[model samples]
Target: MSFDKFKPKYKIHSETENYFKLRAEAGAKPYDQLTVEEAREGNIANAKRFAGTTEFEGTVKEFTVPSKQCSDGIPITVYRSKQCDLCVAPSVFVYFHGGGNVVGCRQTVDTICRIFSRDAPCVVVNVEYRLAPEHKWPANHEDAICVVRWVKMNKGLLGAVNRSTVGVGGDGEGSRMAALVCHEVPDLGYQVTCIFHASAA
Candidate 1:
């Protein structure tokens, strides 16, 4: 006697297949949808959060990192305190401004940087990276890294930061940029002692 085997066949539902295809097509990351203005607003909110209870009641020295172009180049505003013991600080904080990568400047975050400078008494390098829509993605990241690397290379010329200890930090989009710089630019040859990301987006 021979036994017959039955095979089960299933129908392909067009609706289900279409639904899955649509989902796969929409699998992009959420950030891909954010507008420049929305990103900027988010960064500002993050900056406010980082500008915490720290206060400054001391003298500060203003210094700039030299640059070729001012439009979308990396510029730095340093706030230094006479009371700082740079030799022992073990880290200089290079701060990137928070403007959602769009509309903030060194002037906007001056007070906050000064406060950090006074409180920590370490060199505070406030970076002015390029904004979005005009200067997006790697532009901002490159600017931030360039400034930090330059400072690290010519610490004596800069005269404000401690060469021994250099830290890169920022808030929101700035924070994201700072992290990228820290991770990639090894030639800066500075260790990231601490990253102060005040509400990073």
Candidate 2:
């Protein structure tokens, strides 16, 4: 059957409608059908395409956080608003991308980080945690905790004050990770001012 017949009747913005149409046209294979490497490549490609088409008015910097086993450390991208320097001390927003612990990287959510940095007027840090089943359980969660600690320890370099507001956010699987971080981290209440998940009501 034609994909158009499956389009929702509910009202949606033209841009969103176009996106859905394009997605349908692309005929991308389901995640379950693709190998992990193939899925990662597709996810990265989609992110790059979206980044290219969208306009983000923020300064982006790349950094790495030391991981438990890997000496290379975890990759992270920091997005700061253009006016961040004008503020007394900008807040920090750590973001985790929403793949099912298997298919996303830091670049997968570049646009989301840019949007948060610009709209919230905060420093947005995108974490690139190791995925599974290559890494196994608790690896992603462990990385999340480590990144949070790293940010807390280096707030000065991140353009945030010691007691400045810090928040954690994510979508889908990433949301689960954010919630876990908030729950499992000791004395997190003293540092994290908020926890935001797109799927949370």
Candidate 3:
């Protein structure tokens, strides 16, 4: 049977519905809500908050940008592809995964990245930054910066990603990173053409 046909609908708890109603009355719009700017901030916050809540547990592949020396470490667990194309498509999207600056992994965001790669017909880089509590504030941020820099430095390794047309997005804590990266576009010598922050805590 088709999965959609066999899909089951579980009833939501009354309390849950009530809570949602309360929020709706309080000027909360879950779908198609808020202006572009407002949504951007809210989503970024959610990505940052839910950093340690979700994950991807399964077989995974690894990609490395090996350093020339022992000090130049470079190997990232890739959850998506970065094949270069020869066409003049659009820009690339460098994504950051959310894990509250604590948990979560690149595998957690793999599926989404694949979809994005196909849909946007552009390059997508899912940054694997260091977690927090063990690293702290600038730790993850620094990792993010480095990853973006690496992508730019090695765009050829990335799938035909147009360096001029780049975007950054994230979930919860990742969303926070996305926003920060977006703002630092000029400073990073990268013009983050677009920014999307979703359900960011």
Candidate 4:
């Protein structure tokens, strides 16, 4: 029986295909089967192996936002591109990285945040929210809300004091948190999501 008749409607990206092939060759276990530590390590390894380097021209700094959920606080990295005007402050974005709220960290999306700051030309506030199998539900969500609220209130931290000066966003699961935040927080200037299908309503 010829199976050519059964064709896939969506084409797989070459890089994605290569990833699966490589994983299979290495006998990698499915994500669900792996221990939390293994999954987190794999995420870091994949990011380093596949994510291309960017020529970022910017100033980078780190700070912590006082979380409403806990005393530990949320850590954040601030990226300000060289192109940003010294006199006129740019809008700031509270960024989150995707890892199903289970894995991934600030470094996982560090370079991507640089690209956003350089290309999108905004101050990128990369967030480090709590992970699961540890902090549990409402912890990560509350952390995101706390950070955005903190940014909204402490606009001077990023020098984004002007109108429409604060926004929130992320990729994948992180993007999901951003969308949820938009629903809860009022007057969020903008939302930048990468490869996330948020509801139009």
Total colliding residue pairs, candidate 1: 2
Q: Regarding lDDT, does 1 or 4 come out ahead? A: 4
lDDT of 2 at 111: 77
* TM-score: model 2 vs. ground truth: 0.80
Per-residue lDDT of candidate 1, residues 81-126 (tens digit): 5546544543467887665566667765777777767766667788
In terms of lDDT, model 2 sits at 0.74
Runs with alpha carbons beyond 4 Å of true place in candidate 4? 1-7, 196-201
Clashing pairs in 4: none
Model 1 lDDT, full chain set: 0.60
Q: What ranking emerges by lDDT with the best candidate at the front?
A: 4, 2, 1, 3
Score every model by TM-score.
0.59, 0.80, 0.55, 0.87
Model 2, residue 58: C-alpha shift (Å): 4.9
* Tens digit per residue, CA lDDT, model 4, 59-163: 898889886578877998999888676537688889999888887888889888898888878888999999998988888889899899888887776756656
RMSD of 3: 12.4
Off by over 4 Å in 2: 1-18, 51-58, 186-201
The local lDDT score (0 to 100) that residue 77 gets in candidate 2 is 91
Which stretches in model 3 have alpha-carbon errors above 4 Å? 1-62, 65-87, 161-164, 187-201
Q: Tell how far residue 148 is off in model 2, in angstroms.
A: 0.3
Candidate 3, residues 1-201, lDDT tens digits: the string is 113432366555667555445444545454355554454454444334332332333223454543332234534543333322334644567777765665556656666766566555456676767665555678677666666666666655554443445567777788788777766554343333333332221
